[model samples]
Target chain A: MKIERREFLKLGAAVAVGLGGGLTLDVLTKTKPAAAETRTDVAGTRVSSKALHAKRWAMVVDASKFKTEEDFRRVKEACVKAHNIPDFGPDSKHQIKWIWEEPFERTFYGVDDPYLPEAIKKENFPVMCNHCENPPCVRVCPTQATFKRPDGIVGMDYHRCIGCRFCMAACPFGARSFNFVDPRPYIKDINPDFPTRTKGVVEKCNFCMERLDQGLMPVCVEASNGALVFGDLDDPTSDVRKILDTHYAIRRKPELGTGPSVFYLVGGGGAGA
Target chain B: MLEKALSGSRRYWAWIVFLLLLILVGFLAYMRQFEIGLGVTGMSRDVSWGLYIAQFTFLVGVAASAVMVAIPYYLHDYKRFKDIVIYGEFLAVSCVVMCILFIFVDLGQPMRIMNVILHPTPHSMMFWDMCVLFGYLLLNFIIGWTSLGAERKGFPHPHWVKVLAYIAIPWAVSIHTVTAFLYSGLPARSFWLSAIMAARFLASAFAAGPALLVIFLLILRKVSSFKVGKEALQALAKIVAYAMIANVFFFLLEVFTAFYSRIPEDMAAFQYLFWGLDGKHSLVPFMWSAAVLALLGIALLVIPRTRKNEVILPFAMAAVYLAAWIDKGVNLILAGFVPNPFGQVIQYAPTATEIMIVIGVYAIGLLILTVLYKVVLGVREERA
Candidate 1:
């Protein structure tokens, strides 16, 4: 029952924290809900005259419609130009890409179809961040710098990101990219409406959160002709859900249990070879 | 205590100056990196982490090894470890300092590091890792300094010091376990998503930590009045032998699981490490070297004749240390990111700038260790 100097100090600290620290924490937490609403507004919801609202956002990519390399290039260019994603050239290891093309085998892994249709086999699939319903990236992010919004957009606060790249490691889709260098100089054309990321912060396709706030569709969807469908997944009547319902769509690495919001329509292109 | 480090032999001063010079070079490289970006390093979108995180991972093991010394002396009340436990604690202090620095340098925004604490996300293993690492540093620093000070004044350590020592034993295991969780919990990297990751990390840390302690104690015995008896060194060697065997056994278990099950994703990283996976064999040589060295270390340590030889023992310990460093540090972090999620292989070699920064962090850690050890040597010499 003897209290030594160390125990005495511990008791004092406990008392101080119980009284002063609790009061400080109370003041801090009291203002949290108001601040969180603003955070949600800044990150997800903005009350515009024509702003789009949805419980969960999702995408359906008609892989068959992307017949030529130009189809992929168009959407990529639209995203890059709109986001001010720097062009580090083809050979640069430090390239930042928002949307890019991957081979069919690489995109939807575990596919061992030997006699795929020539059209489907030759075509490159467009891949980007799935904005997962249960994002591992968000779970691993130390600072809540990346989080999931109510609308199902996996959002990133670049300023808050400490650039640990935990998100990059957590993302199974290879979606996230870190700015290895100052990205401003590499940007061919700076998008004034959108802010460019500094070196060190992790970034990926944000489903055009900024554009969505303005009642505009994602630039990729707009530039994708009929290949890309973006809408509310929570609403079954939405275009993305409708396409998902009608087609035998598959997500990237579904077995991993990330519940990818993005789906690709396969076997929808003519008959198999 | 602080003044003891200020006065040292010509050779000690020379070593200090050399570390300072390396620190200077590293500082300059870091400033350049700060102005430019991590682009100065070889990391790309494909391979995000490299040497900095690797060194951090390795040092965490070295830091956690203090528990090996603590358990025998403090928990088991073994008198043989009484003189050396302080050395183990001081070594832990320096390593934890280096671990924090490595994380600091690896940060995209070092200035914004407080954000992790400010917005606490208990769900993030990185957050837990930060908490445990810092807590371990504080624990070791207080325990080592307080106990050493009491000894310097010719009195037993206060009652609470013993309590803190017991707490530190579990704290040591937690630091490395939390670090393993940082990788193991990730869904993307098939290489790291293993249930045995924490067990493997603890096994390696136990081996590598004590092996390092043996080397440091041997060096201390040679150059100073500090001399541990042969029995203590032998006891440490036994710990290293058993732990090294456990580490290798755990790794073989992983190999068996990967190959026998024939999970392509699980096998891809092992293939990338041991043999060239799709003509990308950058890490194959390192992995093989670690395997050979680990086996050699085990052979040297397992045999009583070689383990007892003070001259040969240091070499065996060095081999153990390097193997653990390469396996846990280099291979684990780098190869885990390979064949990325897209099944693409992008080669990642640390840039010269990255290496310099790494050396700088090591120099800082070594400098701290030298100063702390100097103080220990000074206090012991007075007692003698």
Candidate 2:
């Protein structure tokens, strides 16, 4: 909630002076008069487009409920539909890349291997884009195609992506994907409302921007089978806000200081299960 | 035969022809890649960087190797280097030519490379890399030409030539270091996040680049009309030996630090590459091969009898080059991001087109080196 103004100033000063009042500054401003009233499934929150960007979007996953494959698949489908993303058959080269299902028992290569919860005998968390506070992808992109929104969501300007994929390399998470071939071949039915990417552009989860634009909850949140909780970290009254406050939610790569928006609840068993 | 051996043989024509044919095939492959986009390659989401980048990293060492010849001729006042210094400049020219080509095929839009000058990202290391590579390329060309022209006219090298020659030393260091910054600065990939990445890159470049140059020199000695005495190459090889030793030591230091510190996040990457974390065994052999090659190269260079043996030295250098190239390139760069942040492991292999682009670029470099060497060799033969 407290975006350190001093830290922004320090980073901004070292950067090009021409980049004045970018999306970060837009975060503090009010939304347009029109989009001020809309519904999000999270209880105790009604906000405008201005309010949308004012608060950084974040997710809290309660890994306890993700005990079944059905639970994980339900949320994955929901997120995909909400984004209007086409998921081609497995092994299809043109498969529309989106959300990942990480096995629960996994540890950061050499990092901690915490005790496996009883329920998560075959555990892992579903991961999308973290929408990092400091995105390396945005930094390395020569095209400036992938920029972060004011509310801490990483947005893509598909029109601008020359598909250089430097962002793909710069990203530590491997969160980004490149359309190596023509994506249209795989896009069986085009979603006119939500656009598809051209070949040679890099893409990843947009944190369900299309849904956010229409004042609806991200499809992943609705599909999460009570596993995923979405909320504004700035607002203490919201359900996602409440979840983060009540339970000990874990953020990925806490040391990286990218301020990941996705949170994980514990669950999952030993590896190779 | 001895007189011709002292100069350099006509076998240069055969190498030139062979490289040209490879380059032609490579150009055809690149055209196909451009038409189809990168999908022709094995790259997917999990494995982002593949062969193009690997070749770029390797040839960059070749480009940086020019510094060996540059320093002795321009700085240390080693008179013996005069005969081969043009070859050094020519080698840098070709390697850089190849470096730029490898990158050209890797880009999504080759035309957009011009954006570098237009956008001018002062903060981005990539921006700096572009500037350094071009500058290094131009500087080597100018220095080599002027030196060759002076040698032809049977006059002492002009003073203005030394200006560019001296600048090439630190400039050589900058190209590879800046390339290192391309990766080491990325905080997310713990494998490339080490503080000594720049030094490690330089150490590895020193090890591989000069070894390549030494081998090339020996081949030229045997087949070419040009002649290089042992003293000049011994000076270069001695330095290469130390660089190889340092490179191996630095690699060990990273291994020690990763394991000793027990930073699982960092170690996880090493485990995936070296010990096959998550039941994957793809990159382990390449990693071990590089380690073994590094040791063998050091052994050859360290021992006087083996080091002095022409047959053994060239063979040793070849082995060292392969090892270091794989270490800095394929495994070090690609395997860093396996299983991605989302725990999805993606595998990558370069397509034929990707390999072709690599070859084409080498062809272009060879073309440049060939012409430059011809001009220099002509003058040297006349003078002798």
- DockQ for every model comes to 0.62, 0.31
Model 1 ranges with Cα > 4 A deviation: A1-46, A269-273
Q: Judge candidate 2 at residue B129 and give its lDDT.
A: 84
Predicted model with the maximum TM-score: 1
lDDT of 1 by residue, B1-384 (tens): 778889989989999999999999999999999999898998888889899998999899988668999999998999999989988999999999999999999988888999998899999999899889989999999999999899999999999999999999999999989999999998899899999999999999999989999998988888877887899999999999999999999999999999999988899999999997889999999999999999999999999899889899999999999999999889999999878877888889988999999999999989999999999899878887
Of candidate 1 chain A, the 10-residue stretch with the lowest lDDT total is A24-33
lDDT, candidate 2, B147-204, per-residue tens = 6677667788788888878888899999989988888888678888888988888998
Docking class of 1: medium
The top-ranked prediction according to lDDT is 1
